[model samples]
Target: MRQKIIAAAIAAAAVVAAPQALASEELNFDAYRQMLADGNPAELFEMEGEELWTTARGPKNATLEKCDLGLGANVVVGAAAQMPRYFADTDKVQDLESRLMHCMDALQGIPSAEIINGSFLKGERAKVAALVAYVVGQSKGKPIQVDLAHPKMKEMYAMGEKTFYYRTGAMDFACSSCHSQDGKRIRATSLPNITTSKGAAEGWGSWPAYRVSNSQFWTMQHRLWDCFRQQRTAEPVFGSDVTIALSTFMAGKGNGHEAVWPGVKR
Candidate 1:
């Protein structure tokens, strides 16, 4: 009976210690990332993206220096911080990737179909990824300030919230399954609980990032596509409304937090 009591005590102690252990591990991982931040390979992509922004290309032979990223023309500085906002020209709420595609089409004469239909990291889509890296790098320390004032933006945010909790597919997983709470992890990666403002900022502001595991820079749109694929649901088209809506929701939730764009991810 004494041995049984001791065993039970030991088990209880272990249960109590588990969360502390996980927290320590997460801190260690953050330190590791900080150590690697100085040499992050995302900088290469940023440089390439900057070049793409300034160089003339496509049928129009125009530089994207004139692209309107919710600021006036040719303004790249800090524009990404307020993105996923309403644009009157398109009569739509556009995220960074979609807005870049718009500029590529309207200003550079690269048809939107090329990006919508092309595979990621290939051809025109690849150019957009580089552009994303560049634009996001420009907004690294800026606050996420997505404006939800417009009726369309409010509508998109609502759709995104609905989509976030709607579960289907073979695994029966909604995004909320993995991201709605704290202390959840998949293998070594700690899942951010995006239901909270801080978590939403971490999840939303850190994307358009370089993934160390895949050796690829993934835009927010690409990340959402992968999320759908992982959920065993039909992946939406690139720049589809659902993707933009999700961006709006997360960005709106993350308003006032600092962006960590062009981030490096494991």
Candidate 2:
């Protein structure tokens, strides 16, 4: 028993000394990321998205030019920061992807299934992602300002907060486990604590981004789906209530930060 205790003490000492040992390596790694930021390929997707937004297509042959993003009809610029807010027509708080689905269905007469069935890099779904990129880009440099005033909006906010912290799955990992603390990392990627304003702004602001590994445009919905898959949870239905609720939580947390969409990702 004494020998076992001595071994445990050594193990604890090693963990305590680990960060100091790796500190220099961590600095070098962060510097590498800073270097990559200059020429990120996400700009390609941003350009494609801009074209898709105004270009007309489909059987009925309509562009998304007149699509409403909750501010009013045909208002695209700077609308992203205001999202995850309550919409009277829908009578619920909706996020970027859900709101985009609404516009695609109502304005273009596109079936939601067809859009969801489409690949992230091809077909109607890609177009929606592009539109999001363009719209969110317009809000670049503008402060994030998600509203939670309406009663239903408040309810959704509460639900979202609960969901963010609730842990269940084979891994027993909640979003908070990885993100509740600052300066944690997984596989060299710095995990931001998205529950806080600073972290939320950083994470939420940079979606509709180009992913380096996949070489494809990824919207917020795609980001969330991938997260769940990694968590070993059942995949969320595209733009489902749970996803939107979580988005509401993030967006509300990020209020007052700028929107920087079509962001470059490592």
Candidate 3:
């Protein structure tokens, strides 16, 4: 079925004339995505995440059912949509992955270093990816509601905004270089102007997605890490302040837009 869908999409794309190919290709890609929605591979990760959330593991042999994701403990619904918020317990603004790390340590006695130092889609980091998949799945179609009321959150946002436009690395490329404008494409992928709210939402909300090209699930942290790699900048530590700050900036800008989390990407 998936192959058939892909073939159909390819056939549709092949008929476009050279002058209109780019625009028509994008439309066909959207149609292909819609056709695959019911069978997204992310669902498998979501199931794994749900099991991880409920099962006892780590040193303490306790479950993360009580983990607070910016809402009250054990509240799975709509919680992710409001993340990257200030948590008084830590006295810092944290995104979903960082907060989950805190909960794993506090509630399950899992060391943060295990996840931070691990490779993507391997060992503990793989579990984190699955957990992220499950958590964000619940917030699908919910409005993005990241709050920047706290001083820490505001500071993070400022840092994120600076980071977005700050040019560095060998290529002297900032995130804004690729994403600040409309009608930009890197190969077949459309670059969203994340400086705008709609673009921010499209950029921020549709992450922690499953990449069809690689057949692997990626957390937002992984996404940012890759972005830095592409820009030839120093890769930030996993769940580091800079990554959270960037997340805060995008989430704040994306407020009120619907989340399309656990999204499937080409």
What are the models' TM-scores?
0.89, 0.84, 0.89
Candidate 3 residue pairs that clash: none
lDDT of 1 at 145: 92
> Top TM-score: which candidate number?
3
* Among all candidates shown, the one with the greatest lDDT: 1
Error of 1 at 228 (Å): 0.8
Over the full model, what C-alpha lDDT does candidate 2 score relative to the true structure?
A: 0.74
Between which residue pairs do clashes occur in model 2?
A: 144-256, 144-257
Alpha carbon lDDT at 187, candidate 1: 76
- Which ten residues in a row are the worst by lDDT in model 2? 27-36
Q: Candidate 3's residue-wise lDDT over 22-57, tens digit each?
A: 345453356645544667778777888998999999
* Candidate 1 backbone collisions, by pair: none
Of 1 and 3, which scores higher on lDDT?
1
lDDT (0-100) at residue 103 of candidate 1?
A: 95
CA deviation > 4 Å runs, candidate 3: 1-28
Model 2 misplaced stretches (Cα beyond 4 Å) = 1-39
Candidate 2 per-residue lDDT, tens place, 1-266, comes to 64365345434543443354456565324443344355445544556667776777665577777777877877877788888778888776778777877777877788888876666556777777767777787787788898888887778878888999889888998888788888888877888789789898877887867654445668889998888988888878887888888888888888887766657554
| Candidate with more favorable, higher TM-score: 2 or 3 | 3
Kindly provide the TM-score of model 3 when superposed on the true structure, using C-alpha atoms: 0.89
